[model samples]
Target: MTRKLTTLLLAATMLLGAVSASHAVDFKIKGVWNMNFEYGSGGNFTERGRSVNGNKAAHVTGWGRYGEDQFEAKSRVRLQLDAVASESLSGTVYFEIGGVTWGRSSKGGALGADGSNVVKIKHSYLDWVVPQTNVKVRMGIQRVFLPDFTTEASQAFDADVAGIVASAPINDNLSLSAFWVRPYNDNWAGDTQSPQNYLDNFDIFGLSAPVRLDGVNVTPWAMLGMFGSNTFRKGDDFYGKNSTGAGALGLAPAVYALKDSKVGRQLADAYSTVLWAGITGEVVKFDPFRVAASFNYGAVDTGVEALNRKGWYSALLAEYKLDWGTPGIYGWYSSGDDDNIKNGSERMPNVEANNESTNAMSSFGTLGTWTLGRDTLIGSTFAGTWGVGARVKDVSFFDKLKQTFHVNILGGTNSPSMAKYIKGAKGVDGHTSFTPDTGTGSADFNSANYYGLYLTSQDYAAEFGVTTTYQIYDNLRMLVEANYIALWLDQSRGVWGGYTATDGSRVGGNSTTDAWNVNVSFIYKF
Candidate 1:
């Protein structure tokens, strides 16, 4: 991705399509398939839960690591295509693959990389529309905008050649949304190719960028109206460092000869920058008060900051949705960027110049772009599904029994030095991307901090379900539903391990260090 980074991403997508332009572009490019054709029978969940593999401040320096019972998938298939979008312009082709005759899976959660059957091209792009004020913008190799709902995990999943966006709506209250991304932070879907690689820092916050088939993102934005986004760039790409673990380097081996030097990827291990701006609408509507805020100065290494590497970082976030019940209550906060004595200041590293004397937080910080579980929140949770992974009849596999207790999920643990134990991160043995505190944990069921990160959640997320019947015959009935989640941590990571304990006799966590992930899925709906 170099041709001057592809001409500064097409001059930042035509200067954001010359700003404030949008009108006629009806929009509709269909064909997005989702398949899960199940038959019957199920059983698996030993380490099935806290798979906490890597990313999310992996494991501060013992470099994060995870490997257990993997090789599963009963039935699945997916296909993507746009085949249509109406005026101005649009195009598509998104590939998909699952199951394996060649990609074969004995069973654990199957997809295939060597189990055979793995195909990719995920997305391609093209878009244009600027005649009035409808803001129809679309740029190449896209999709990297952390819009709510913790999808499979976080750590500020980065992505690039990017730009996620919106603009157009001055009347329904307000309008505008954003992304100026720069990802390629390696992982490409993980589980293969390891021999000491190390490229993952164009920071797109929290991993996972799959929205190809020619890029295009839209969000006319409304409600009191205010939105802002920023993704930065500087260069050098050694990417955050937790150092020490698996092939240990633990700082001082002259930091691997300055990452094998050439002024460490040009002028001391360069990472980049992004700045965000915000203002959201709807400040009083019957029972509403919606607002958003952003103030940023950039320098990112993904998932909050992961040890600053090169230099500088800054951030802020806000949310207030009060109307009570249904969908309300979401709080946010962000602030990163600490490192002065800039531009080639003493050749970077050294825990990124000791994170400029500590404010301690940025193992992929948290708040929007959701770094990594600062409380994996879910709003008023409830769930359902059945056959074909059924999405509702009672949620997830037609139910015969169920239970509830207002839900919200995602667990906690991160913040020790900056997590990220190990796995891919540009081919393993890179000793994780730092941030300590057992590099985030879960798979057991503990720390739920008022329910989030991972206490228990299903039915999309943030749950509340209840099913009870005991008919026995006729059509048949006999069920039990009892699922409750509320695990928590940040009891202040045992209050900063007794302030970096010298021996006040705190010995930092491990009564199995509180981890959580609830389970209860029993079914038979006929």
Candidate 2:
């Protein structure tokens, strides 16, 4: 499948190139392939799917896979429009072919258990840029990212065929971007490869109103965003229907009618019209000395009552470069309980059971890395989090040798993704109980007032690591890293699936799941 997709894409590119060459020929190509060799397998890294960035521990993988090592390659090529000649319009036509045990934000990066492998046209989208107006409009299939969606974050999916995106620079230092995108109309809209992601992909347009400011230093910008729902929710699609329906996935006709309420249509429309805004600024900046802040509030806009959760999230990031190593620190915190859910008395009702309801509505992506010898290592951690992490790095060693240390004593109370662990008594379903996933009825919030169990928010554990990468050649590099994490989950610290978690710590678990991790990766960029 991957080869065919690759061949088809390459052939298509060639054909297009030939056609354009003969006629208007406004097309150009851009491509990049990132390949990796990884070792130390135990952890969620290999199980859930492929980690494009080579992230080591996500619940998707368990602990034992950490020590395992292997190598793989992934890449994408794009056909672009020469801004000078074809005006400012461009689109990408590419595919991926490779094998890896790590999973990424999308199913394309999944690690197959059979090791048979995967290769296909992961994504392709087009964009139109207006250099003069500093405005770029991109439509077709595209990637959509949200503010606080942690894990593969963004409580959403891949691009939509009818999606639209526009980004324009308001001034020298500030710019704004807005997009109306989705991957599914309801549940059964397209390919069923990643049912959870694809079906759950929605029919919505998220708009980010314009905001401008000067520079990242003390500059303030305001942003307003609106999300418009699509036909998938109109009961004609496969996903938005009730779970019991024999159809693909449509809502119950009666419910869709809203019990004959005067505001049925309006309420439904408003539910889809989730609104959110934020103010951000970077006040301090002196080389490594940097300070930035932001506050965002938005309704869940799931188009469902109660599930139409509201949120307020904020963060403060600052950096300071030092001699030993560059020391950096930052943290973010947001309230997930802002959802009122229409008086909180509503039961999980009939609505399509596609994928929308399962979203974590989180923020942050994942950091990818690798390791070398046991104590010595190299890795990269870039996914966003609730902030509260600091680091110091020194790259003066052996030219390629870099000695560094970091501390991420950060944790959030309610994370859609499994950042923290499940502590205390297990729910009826083996999994520790929580809201959204299990609904509000399972675990009591502030009732007994316990960390992982009682709804009381949890604090972040202190996570720190030292890593280094050496350039073996201009296009290839070797990396290794070692990390030490002390989680604050006294009774039920954090739960890392792969390692050895006696209590809550494992291979690197605090009590049961905590243990030192050694990783390594060889990377070649083409």
Candidate 3:
């Protein structure tokens, strides 16, 4: 089935390309393939998964469990087709074949685990340039936006959704873009037991305008997003009326209705609205200096009758080029949850789950570096955290070999106090716990908490690391990195236990006080 689908898609795409080319319209086909090799000292360097919060032990586990010398390889391929239909219209089809695992399958075969590979249509859209106007409309599945600079240290605002985007050039120096985006709606609308019940119907709208001034460009943007099914909420009563008519005996109709309300309320509280503004520009057109900065603030209105959700983030980056290389520095700060789900005057939810205040740093494939320090120390900058780093690029001794070097230091405190949220937990040895009222009972509030189970670790922890990449060719490179981290688990002692502390002083449970890691990656791109 997989092979047949791949053949059919490729055949159809090729046929379209041939026919479109014969029409005299511009048609182009391009692709990129990257082969990656990874080796890590504790085997932890190659671990893959979304970050789990508050799990200090999970973060500290050395990859040695995988093996003393761990090595893994993977490949990715992307194909893009561009066809210009007319003077004012064109279309694009971009597909990405990902998760093509290599080596032995789960059953010990050479191919891979059963059905472990998958393909995705990352972007497929039609572009229509309105006649006699500067407006253009793009409709279909597409990326939210691709920034001109880089998403190395922050990517919290990026998303790919099926939607429509419109852009208008107000003048030669100014332009505006807006988007109304959402993913496909699900079919389990009336199925109470389906996991789809908890999935919200996400509606997102965004507007941004860029103003170019001489050598500098400024973009002011705002996004309004909501998740909930106006349809599902209304169908609550309908389903409730038919309980047991066509559904399983244990799955009551009210369960579906309640799930809708609970999921909607949680999502609303998780990320109600987001507003941010930013500017990007060069210091001198003739010189190699550039800067970009942005600030974002938002709130989660859980409407849970007890909790409040709110968080904000800010970041800045600057770079300069000299005779040898380009040097850059970046820093960011994001609010963390200062209080667990407390009630009354204490109901504070900084950087709430739905608030979307996390900062997206670079990733392995996206930025060519694994977040060793970030993952070990703070999991992700999306929670309450701050960090600064310096990077130098393109240092070359010979024309064929160039190097890029980076060093970053980061710190963070736990958000939402996982201990307070969970039962049967006493305070960490160093931190204080809050027992404020939880007010009304909403569906566990677990939906609003992304942090993991109670783990011993300090609130104020620090991590630092250095990484270097040697580019053997323009499209081929080798990367290596080493990281060190020390967590401040003892908030009471004013310092998390240092290398000398024992489990008695750690929070939640026995957590590592200090950890070290090393990793290397060989990449080839075409």
Candidate 4:
């Protein structure tokens, strides 16, 4: 961190402390802490190796020989302080610390190195209710535009921004909200060699309506965003059409040629829009069945005329209560683009973008439920895929502990499109080619360069898991989980198991692997 940031943090802390000491305000402190360890095994492939003749070198991108038989330690803590001036007004200061490391740390009590653990202010916001009405306003740094599950689990949508949010109740069962946010700001920075890079910013606007029904609840929301950055600034006529008059002669030309030129700035803007609707309801009364569904659509300009930037995803789930536990089933689908959009090649102008948008669902952190197929087959529903899952929760033989079990089977909805996106080819070309990239170990499982984008020739995949939680105390718990996945690939498509060389050479041993993991966690809440 820079000195300026340190000073700002100190000032903010002092301000909060002063508020807490004031007679007009009452404050409360609360937090959650979690510590966990994970172990992974199986599925080890060479990242790169020479062919038998030594004339060809092949690179493979899939499960590599890393992260197997290794133990990982991860921990996180959230601290929050809320100061209330009145029932209608309050302010919050929230801090977070989290990190992951391979193996146990040797340091017994001292801080390890910079970035070994992350500590920062996660939220600082003020909430005020308008007198004589149910209108509330929240302003400052906070969370916005994420799903309920995402917010609760602190997973996919765990992003905070500086913004202002206004919400009003239309009636006892309906409410509306609007917000404007700056997700990224360059206002705080030290002198730099290239100041032009710091001139970019991101702005987001959103509106939502939540309605409550007799047996159901629904929330519909929409968001609009604009990203302005110097990343796209380049030579004249290079970014877009250069319609800003590079043709004009004289002093105007000189002005336009500068690094901070108006022409360059205007060309660095991108726009995107999102729409989502979600529903939760009691489907059956006597037997106690519940259902949930979410639908999402997104469009982006990407500032690239030849690239497609539109996609949609949807998920459905139903649960039933039994004498021993609750059982549920779920299915989801995401759209995909045609193979015409080749990898490493220029797409047609106005190409139809696939529904491969990132983090469309809350996968890993959803409490009491596991998105089995979603987590094992793919990181997200991007790139057009579908799957079905079944889960049972709260199978208890004892009062302090309960077990949950889940199984899932996943398949590609658009195999051709998946091939194109994963292996960067189409039809015969893609089928005959191997991916030229690096594989991942257990540690890099979901990274963008690894499993996030490595679903090449997967004909199908299945996953199963069991989790148990023990209540050590009212506010403390211990959890243990074991998971396994079996992935199958179409060998005819030379894109399985290992990577394809840049020149279309293929290398690898097997096309399938049974990967497994075990996790243990301790959590405390106050």
Q: Among these predicted structures, which one has the highest lDDT?
A: 4
- Per TM-score, what order, best first? 4, 3, 2, 1
Give the whole-model CA lDDT for all candidates, comma-separated: 0.25, 0.38, 0.46, 0.48
RMSD (Cα, Å) of candidate 1?
Answer: 24.4
| TM-score for all models, in order of appearance | 0.23, 0.58, 0.69, 0.70
TM-score of 2: 0.58
Error of 2 at 331 (Å): 2.8
Model 1, span 395-484: residue lDDT tens: 232333322112323322122221111111111233222122233442111111111122111112222223333444444344333222
| lDDT tens digits by residue: candidate 2, 1-526 | 3555566667766767676667754555444444443333221222212221112222233332232333322332323222223657656644545433345424245554223334545456666776667688876654554432121222112222456778776676556667665434444343332232232334444544333333333322222333233334333332122222211211112122122232222224422433445555564435557566656554434444622434455666666666655555666654533112122111111112112111111111122231122211111111112446665656454766666556655554443123232222222223223221121122122111110111113434445566667878876676666555443433333332233333553322222233345555565554
Candidate with maximal TM-score:
4
Q: Residue pairs in steric clash, candidate 4?
A: 60-499, 356-382, 356-383, 434-500, 435-500
Between candidates 1 and 3, the lDDT winner = 3
Lowest lDDT sum, 10 consecutive residues, model 1, at 382-391
Q: Per-residue error at 383 for model 1, in Å?
A: 20
| Model 3 C-alpha lDDT versus the unseen true structure | 0.46
Steric collisions counted per model: 106, 97, 19, 5
True-vs-predicted CA distance for residue 35, candidate 2, Å? 3.9
- Candidate 3: segments with Cα more than 4 A from true spot: 1-26, 41-70, 104-109, 112-116, 146-155, 187-199, 229-286, 305-308, 343-377, 380-382, 413-488, 491-526
lDDT of candidate 2 at residue 101, scale 0 to 100: 37
Comparing 2 and 3 by TM-score, which wins?
3
Model 3 lowest lDDT segment of ten: 245-254
